[model samples]
Target chain A: MGELVVDELEVQKYQEQEVEENGLPLVLLYGPLSLLNVFGSESLLNNFRLIKPWESPEIPLHEYLITHAKNVKALVCLGKTELDSKAIHCLPSLEIVVTCAAGLNHIDLIECRRRGIMVCNAGNAYTIDGADYAVGLLLDVLRRVTSGDRYVRSRMWPLKGEYRLGSKLRGKRVGIVGLGSIGSEVVKRLVPFGCKISYNSRKKKPGVPYPYYSSVYDLAVNNDVLVLLCSLSEETFHCIDKDVLTALGKDGVIINIGRGPLVDEEQLVRFLVNGDIAGAGLDVFEDEPAVPRELMELDNVVLSPHKAVFTPESFIELQELIVGNLQAFFSKKPLLSLYKNALSASS
Target chain B: MGELVVDELEVQKYQEQEVEENGLPLVLLYGPLSLLNVFGSESLLNNFRLIKPWESPEIPLHEYLITHAKNVKALVCLGKTELDSKAIHCLPSLEIVVTCAAGLNHIDLIECRRRGIMVCNAGNAYTIDGADYAVGLLLDVLRRVTSGDRYVRSRMWPLKGEYRLGSKLRGKRVGIVGLGSIGSEVVKRLVPFGCKISYNSRKKKPGVPYPYYSSVYDLAVNNDVLVLLCSLSEETFHCIDKDVLTALGKDGVIINIGRGPLVDEEQLVRFLVNGDIAGAGLDVFEDEPAVPRELMELDNVVLSPHKAVFTPESFIELQELIVGNLQAFFSKKPLLSLYKNALSASS
Candidate 1:
């Protein structure tokens, strides 16, 4: 009674039997478990046993899944991990796959549906954070805040001549592409700067206070600063190309917080070099973790490592939301689901 | 009209003669005049002869007085330039000396009186511009906007773990060391951030909405951010010492836009290194044009050259105001002067 102990193997066997009888779910955490600093909460962790890939470094994905497949129910993963049919076949008991990110192109929705699995993504998770970053980038680039800092850091005091002259953001015109969650949030923060806000979306958002442009080129032409906040789809791919950049004119600044593929990188470099655009602030890149040296050479651009939603506060919030979604799904309650049409019809 | 070919020097001489005979008595231009892009504006030019050092770089002070002294009633200058008995004696025709800056430290008021010359300094020229730069510096420092920019430019993508976490200015307590012209302006700008404002001045102004702290130490203790907007003089020099910095505590961030000499540089460096103070945004340093390399090594500080009021708009406004003050002095009308106390007593 004072120090009661149970056989470890017997306890493990009993737990496995209970899981097999109740259809226990498997959740594979593929990326850094330091994300636990983000997603770890007593209520959130109680729902599932997290399988961290880092802890089991040598274990191959197929072998691990096959070994643990009997009672597996779901897989929670990140961008770096690929989920395909061959890998999916190993997890015979897998039912649901959740991606804690907005983009779905990485996940094979058709293949998931064929395997009778539900796919859900975390959409608008980066909306506010991304928007804030875009605004921050805009301010940093236009004001030459970073260049001034670098100058001082290099022990080059008395930054004389044109270096001292930084552009003021007050009363400047800001054009946003795609008035989605992130785009609208960008407008909210920028309103304080007294910028005249205009935007180009697929269609106008009615009852919204800001002016809307019918065409992306028209928005670029009229705005002093053009912000890329649109979604990256077939129609919107490379929408902000040479012609759109030309429309932005010589003194105009362009900020891209959307996907890298949304912009024509070659054309952007050309425009920035030739003074077709005054400057740019980019968070997303084409083939990221591999930023172009050409962009680095230009002092006019402010680049971020696509870290719009990587704040500590945002990470915590994202984790809480993901946990809430999982809990609701398990409890047979309506989940805070994204891409409902795609999920219901196919995946 | 085609036959009337005039000599450039002759035309300049005639123009100078006309100005000496009928134009304004004083022209106090504190800032650089090249900022006024529209040089051909005859109306603006006809208002007053420029007292800018850049325009007449080769002309000695003695030569300037000798050439224009015959009909010149007064002269104009800035606080950076010294106005001693020698300057007064050389400009024998100068009845008044107007300074196009807030401080009168450079102008020898006692000597001006002995020489029977009137002195006036522009007290409000720096108010709004100083406030703008202070807020800009605060935002720049707190958000690590400049550091982020540098990271991006260096082609370094900040992965989740590598990202530098920046603090938000909202809801933070800010202590203003002096509630004077620039300090009051700083308060007005900081109001929108929803920050709690407290201040310490030699004496409190009537109807100051913010809470007043009697002592700098007390203010530093209570506030998360401390902004030095006090005037640099004997009593206030090196006011923010080791003791005050210690009082400011570990979480406090200091922003000094007022003066370099106001902060004890060595003590500040020590505090910064030991994390006694979180960070600083310095627009002025103890030895300007020679900022310490040690300060440059730290990422927690943002340094700018002494350029708080160096905007093109502010420069233009200051020039126009100075010219107006000069015009008033030459007409023998009661000057819209800064030193009315001394002037009335002298008269």
Candidate 2:
């Protein structure tokens, strides 16, 4: 019996040696399919064992972590994934956490710090792309491009009545709620349209071309169109509420490409129905994928999925940046580190 | 009978005297509802007798002209209303033919010249608006912006399996087939995208920034995208045929804001299906309102009813230009014309 036990112990030691020799450190990837396609190609993922738990609908979070947790050294997560203190505690070997996207509200940064786990995110990767898309949506909605196309395709030649008339962007006052990278890019695009740009951020930046306003109500009142580009945080939740919408006045358009929580959805629907606000172009929603039926019925609103940065160029850039971060972390470098500063500064 | 005729003539003279005192000439208008809105408003027609043949699908050219022809000094017409030599010949007192939109192919220019009839069109009125829409279509088609919106709205969240990736317009080679008013306007807007502009007009204007190509095939072969901005005359009909599509290569996109007959519909359909051409954004069609059913299924193509310049700014500008033309024609002043020079130069 003693000899048999010795043999079993020898076999266990051999298996451990094999795993150490050939197995790679863990990387948990979450997000959409594009996230995987962008970063998990064999050539890019050769240095790590990339595990994507969200790829299948049936894979429960606890089951996934329990099965793969012992070997996980790093995790790459998305906005929807639940990565709280409890989830972090399950992964005994997790040394770092990286996000494939810019937003970090999903991950508990304080918990990660408490556990001495490093965290990094892809910031400014989608700024220009998102800004470009927001402007595109604004123009699409105001100009009624999609509706016009539908009218024409229906064999209605030379649209008349209200359908024939569409507002132009030229010379309209555009209010941007945030003057960060995306908002600044939007300003750049709108400049050529000859629009007057007004912005309301937490504080004013020097030497910017647009006029800055401290109060959201003042910004909404003066501007013909309001663009929400601020980040979603505790302070900014429901920042553009009923009072701000009311201050926007009649014949005002509100475009939200930021977070859905930035604007009160119920108030937005009410304002739209009551004709207090002229129209809206929304790319993000409160519940997402389950957009309100009320918004869908309105002809005035233009809706897009939360896909502002899904352009090929932006996607490629995001992939490269995420991969670079991973490689840097493995090399014991700073990991393009931008957590505490961005949080504090943005907050 | 002679006394009755004399009395009728006296009554007609009395009406003419009253009309002249009112200081408005008779204005005959035709075409779609939007055109009527722009050119045939109540205020515009208040001074003049506005004659519309809505009851009769076809304008009764001779009878209508004979009845109201004598005092109808200015005639406002649009495309799809036949204004042939017979019609022009009958309107003996007609001094001007002012079209509310661009494209004068339907007008009998030779007859107008022989009869010394002054002709003016709403030149450059729709240029900026049309160019803006074309660019919008290009960006929208390439980015799959509308498709993305549709997918999300239809409850297809977290889309999987090879989504259509969009290319950026920045730094792409854009070939303008004709550098006329609309083409030039398109170039101005496209400049900000950092696209390299090339052109192939009948004759190259001096000091233009873009390189000129003498042959359409050459332009198609070299360009990443070819935009048809030339007119559709007999000489330029089917100019961008199968050979041109072949030369454009498989990856090139074609945008035609010009005439649809400039492209061979059969060849275009074939190319679009077989992936000989990447995609197309068409505002005009071979037959308006009867778009090819097959083209509708292709995700690559974007179709708009022939409304490239249906903006409020252009609408107001068109009205003002038409009104100015009427004012100038009544004063017997030289018409602010383009065709006399363009035709001669092309010949």
Candidate 3:
């Protein structure tokens, strides 16, 4: 193995030789895309044989998974890959799944729980970065940061006289839709900006100083800006619908750093067009990489391509956490970001 | 005055009759534009006779000022109008100059002090708004909020795939220049975002927890982001010069919400062009209504047309302060936003 040379020839040869070469346990890289290329996945290469099925586009993913299932004891998934029951069934020897993202909606927790497979996510590693992004989006929308940039870039300021004034962020009533890690972080950040913060979570939190509304509609009714940072669950899906948007009213804005399905895109577009809602700063869409064309043209709204949780700093942190979880799982000590609630349920 | 009916007819009539009609003390409204329309300047109209030179464009400004200079006890000046020594000479009877802005650099404080003419600026009225804007601009630049918005708007996201990753705001070293009200406000705002904040003010602030650098160059050298929120003066003009920008390095961003001359705009443009500095968010420029055309093409820079202090909420606060200052001057009370150092120096 001569220090495991990562040459192109060796990389190609390893694809044909799918066994646990050089006494390294196999860790299947499930998807074609991963941020592992960032640090070159050096940490993983040192400890395990990584079989990336998606690297060979000619091979069917299921066929590739089955071929290496006997030796594959772990799997690492990226953003877009689906790890459902069928895929889980393919990797029968897999004992742990590491998702390199804050959200685990793409992973089937029920299937993992039934099979006693521990799942670890990039946990609080992204909390501060995600919260920072949400605040940035809110400020951009309310202060017209992006639109002002466009106006300046278009050589329109000298021609257009003055750009329109945007609403102030300070002292605006802000309702955070969820009070989880990211949402809590948003509250902490907004407090110093002088925003009147309130929130709506699934259940009342005991010690939170913020006034809690029982429902999202009530939260919207009372606040000027509704920040959607809640997880997308069966019960939380499409949480920000026409009714919530209507309650938010004409001068209100929505900032969605949560899943796209949390907001009803059709209703949101209609509201923005008719001036029923003032503006929105959206980082996600129902179908990613495909934003509504209507949103693109609107000067009031700011659009980002689902990049809320990504930053070089956060990516570096995530890579560390992912490696830590993998090492912990292989050593059987404990997974660092293990979804412990599901683990407890199955135990 | 027939109950001082504020009709369209009377508004036109007031332009023709610029004297202290109905025994109201005259307040000369300098320049053509004012945000007076926002709240209708009811506060001013209720207390004083308003004289606007630019209202009747046919009447030359010099001619108009000469006509009403005797009774122009207070002059309300907006952005474009230069209330220089000549303007002070024009308004011979001027007792107080109420500038509708936070910065008093526009007014000749020296001349005003020598002449026993008290000056009142927007004061802390713009403190929070300016700070909010500074934060918005910093976030926009660092997180690529404005550029991301541009990418989405230009219909390039689908073609370009993922936009370039932006530097994270959290845990980065941020240095604020000028620890005045706006600067202090920025410090307060940035603290919660997990930044290690430092500042370079004229002197060390009493009991400030953050480390203090005595010079702008040192502050720039030590920080990842430099926020310009200080007053522009002879001592501080072009404070952020080529050396400061270079010390800030390739990943550092500069956010300017203070007066434009506070930073060397030409050097800033050069640094941004060459990627010597990562980015900048500028709200003010050395020349008003004239930005470097070179800057219009850069994605790394976000330009705002001196709009940091223009929100309706802030404007309303400013109007109240202006009216209060005028009334205070007439009543021989302390001016609301008096440039007190000059007052104390001259008293």
Index of the highest-DockQ prediction? 3
Please give the range of 10 consecutive residues that has the lowest summed lDDT in model 1 chain B: B35-44
Evaluate candidate 1 by giving its C-alpha RMSD to the native, one decimal.
6.7
Estimate, for each residue in B235-347, the C-alpha lDDT of model 1 and write its tens digit.
78998999999999988899998888999999999999888898998878898777877888887888776666555555565666666666777676776655754454443
Q: lDDT for every model?
A: 0.69, 0.72, 0.82
Question: Judged by lDDT, which candidate is best?
Answer: 3
Candidate 2, lDDT over the whole model: 0.72
Which has the better TM-score: candidate 1, or candidate 2? 2
Which ranges of candidate 1 are over 4 A from the true structure?
Answer: A1-26, A37-47, A57-59, A66-71, A79-131, A158-162, A332-347, B1-45, B50-74, B82-132, B155-161, B169-171, B177-211, B324-347
Task: Say which prediction, candidate 2 or candidate 3, comes out ahead on TM-score.
Answer: 3
Q: Write the per-residue lDDT of candidate 3 for residues A28-109, one digit (tens) a residue.
A: 7776434456434666666767786767779787887787565677888865577999888888888899888677888888
What is candidate 1's lDDT per residue for A151-221, written digit by digit as tens?
67766565442345556666789999999887877787677556899999999999888889999889988
Off by over 4 Å in 2: A1-26, A30-35, A38-40, A51-73, A78-80, A90-96, A112-118, A152-163, A332-347, B1-19, B30-35, B40-43, B46-59, B78-80, B158-165, B332-347
Query: Which tens-of-lDDT digit does each residue in B73-170 have in candidate 2?
Result: 77888544667898887778777788865777778877887777767877887777677777777766666666655555555564442245567666
Which is the better candidate, 1 or 2, if ranked by DockQ? 2
**Residue pairs in clash, model 3:** none
Q: What lDDT score goes with residue A228 in model 2?
A: 91
Worst 10 residues of 3 chain A by lDDT: A1-10
